[model samples]
Target: MIRIALKMLVGDRPKYIGMILGVMFSSFVITQQSSIFTGIMTRTFGFINDSPLPDVWVMDPKVQYIDDIKPLQDTQLLRVRGVDGVEWATPLYKGLLKARLSNGVFQNCNVIGLDDASLVGGPGNMIKGKLEDLRRADGVIVDIVGAQGRLAKILPDGSRQTLDIGDTLELNDRRAIVVGIASISRTFQSQPVIYTTYSRAMNFAPRERKLLSFVLVKAKPGVAISDLARNIQSQTGLKAVTAEEFKHMTVMYFLKYTGIPINFGIGVLLGFLVGTAIVGQIFHNFTLDNLRYFGALKAMGASNGTLLRMIIVQAIVVGLIGYGIGVGAASMFYHVSKKSELAFRMPAELLIVSATAVTVICVIAAIFSIRKVFKLEPAIVFKS
Candidate 1:
């Protein structure tokens, strides 16, 4: 009985292929679009992730996200450092400043300032020079992406010349020499990233009373991170969050305030609808075309449960094949887009989500065929 059912499913090549394509397209769109969305959301807190040395981030109470820098007074650092369970605390200055490229072109850049003594929060991947190079007079480090792309000098021939070590940039009339090239994660805004000392960044930034952007703290041995965060907040009257909490805050802010979720959601929903319409309709017709065979089995004393199992087996086979191919294609797309700045990340959980989605599409398709099979009468086997 099962062999006959399997043969019936594969006997019609056109309908079988049509059902597979429908589910394949659905899974591909859902997985691909969701991955891009997750990649972009991950970048919103990329700076926080890059500086993994910090256990908690201290900032002004009103700061909503990583990019939403609410400057803290210089005194705030001392106040946070005074909190219990703090092994060490460092000031981090992060802000956007206009950079006058060596070519005299002006571009907006994300300027990060690390502690002078510890050089904490500096980029991990130093491509050209040492991280300590920032200690040099008027020295700074440029992210490789910025050096090769945005901050690169535009030549007269319409090509870009990558900025090398010792290239000079003018920030707020302050001369900053690129002493090192570091590779860092891409920023949310896709701007050039420049790293300098706390004092130099203050100079580059527009004159303001509050220069500290955040306080990066390291908890002492055996101290509870969450407790330390609460203690810091209570003592300093500022907002303190662990790295993971801050990342969640940033992601939530974007999801609540931005259109990113809605946009990608539309693509996924469309895929679901397309899969339902095509697969459901074709599978139903295929079942109807085989009504005579089902009725013959019913007359032979085959239970309805047995016939229902046959439909389920067919759906499972098609779903697995379609889903396997769809996810494979998406993985290929991810690799191809890696070089082109197309943000794509496929974590293990994403694969599970895609599988569930494909399963739902298959179940819905099978339901239509199931209803038709269950309603058939064995008398139909003798007609025509």
Candidate 2:
């Protein structure tokens, strides 16, 4: 019975292909859009992800996210250190500073000032030069992406040159030498990242009363990280959260306050609707055309239950084929786009979601066909 049903479905080349393409289109759009959205949201907390050494991040109560600079007073650092269960606390200065390129062009840079003593919250990977090189006079480390991009020097001939060690940039008119090059995650702002010591960053920053941006803390051995974070907030009247908690907070803030989610959501919804329309209409028409055959089977003692199973089998075959092709294409697209600035991440969980969407679309398309088959009349075959 199943073999006969599949032969009936495959005998019509155009309709078979159409049904597959419908589901494929939906799977592709849903997978592609969702991956891009997830990648972008992940970048919002790129700084926290890169600074893996710090277990807790302490900031001003009003600071909503990493980019929100509600600068804390310099004394806030000492206050956080005074909390019990803290192995150590280090001050970090994060702010935008204007840089005067060697070519005389002015560009803004995301300046990260690590603790002068501990150098906590520095770049996780160094492509060239040592992390200790920041100790050199007027030294700064530039991220590799920025070095090859915005921070790169432009030639008089209209070409650009990648920044390298021993290159110099002027920040706030203070000379900053490129003593190291580090690999850092690209931030949400997409600004060139510059790493310098806390005290040096203070000089580069325009004079402000509160120079401290955050306090990076390490918990004592065997201490509970979450509990220590809570203690820090209570003792200092500041906001403190574990690293993972801070990351979740940042991603959630963007989701709630930004239009990013809505934009991608519309794309997925359109894909589902368009797929349903195409597959539902064509599959129904195909079933109507084949009604005489179903009627003949009924006349020959085939029950409605058997006819129902046959329709489901046909739907499953088309659904699986379409889904496999669509997801394969999406994965290929991601690999090609990775070489460029495109942000795309498709995890296993995302694949499962895409599969579920395809399954639902296929089920919706089959519902109409199933109804027609169940109502088929055995006498109709004799008339035709």
Candidate 3:
């Protein structure tokens, strides 16, 4: 019965193609938009995601997210380090600074300061030059995305090229050299990033009474990160959270405080509505056009249940094919744009949600067709 239903569906080449295309368009829009939303949300916690060495993050109690930098007093670092179950703790300086490019252009950049001895909180990967080169006077690491944007240079070929190892810029009237290029996750703001020692970062950034932005701490062996974080928060009177907890906190903060979630939700809802409208109308019309054949089968002793099953099988085939094409296209888009500034990540949860949405569309479309067919009179075939 299923095979016969599939053959019947395929026999009408035009309607078959239209049905698939409708579902395909719907799935593409929903999947792509959802993936982009997830990607942006992930970037909200890029600092914690990139730095895996820190088990606990200590920050000001008022700080809601990573970008909400409420600078802590330098003495806070010592306080966090003195907490029991803390293997070690280091100061991390994070601030926004304006850089005077070699071309005399000024651009805002994100500056991060890692510990001098351990280089904790530094970039995870370096594309050029050694990480240790950041130890040199006025030396700093520039992220690849930043280099390609604010630090790009125009070539004779009329193309822009990212800054190289020897590129130099000015920060706070001080000469800053790009000693290395680091490959880090692109931030939501897409700002250029610079990394240097805590002391150098302090010199480059505009002077402030409190320079320490965060305290990155690692828990001792056999110590639970949550327990250590609680201990630090109690002892130092600062807000402390495990790395995973902080990431979740940052994501939740953006979702609740920003309009991003609402916007994405609207997009997905529109996709669902559009898909249902297109597929539902077409499938209903298709069933009506085949009413004479359906009446003939019923008159010949085919049960209504058997006819309904055939319709469902046909809908399932169309849904599967259309969904496969849409998802494959979205995946390919992510793969191709991974290196570009446009962030698109198709997480497993997104794929599952997309599949469920497509399934709902198909079921609804089938239900409409089933209703029309179930009302038909078998004797109507003879009249026709």
Residues 1-384, candidate 3: write the lDDT tens digits: 778788889998888999898889888889999999998998888878888999999999999989999999999999888899999999999988998887677889899999998999889899999889999888999998888887787666767888999888899899999899999887776789999999998898787899999999999999989989989988888999988888898999999999999999999899889989999888888888888888888888888999999999989998999899889888888888877777687988898999899999999999988887899899898893
Candidate 3 C-alpha error for residue 69, in Å: 0.5
Q: What TM-score goes with each of the models?
A: 0.98, 0.97, 0.95
lDDT of 2 by residue, 133-247 (tens): 9999999999998899999999899899999999999999999999999998777988899999999999999999998999999999999999999899888999999999999
lDDT of 1 at 145: 93
Error of 1 at 287 (Å): 1.0
Worst 10 residues of 3 by lDDT: 150-159
Clashes of each: 0, 0, 0
Query: On a 0 to 1 TM-score scale, where does candidate 2 land against the true structure?
Result: 0.97
- The TM-score-based order of candidates, best leading, equals 1, 2, 3
What shift in Å separates residue 371 of candidate 3 from its native position after superposition? 2.0
- Whose TM-score is higher: candidate 1's or candidate 2's? 1
Query: Which one is best on TM-score?
Result: 1
For all candidates in order, the CA lDDT equals 0.92, 0.92, 0.89
Tell me, what's the RMSD of every candidate?
1.0, 1.3, 1.8
Where model 2 places Cα greater than 4 Å from the true spot, the runs are none
Candidate 3 global lDDT: 0.89
What's the CA RMSD of model 1 in angstroms?
Answer: 1.0
Q: Alpha-carbon error at 324 in model 3, in Å?
A: 0.6
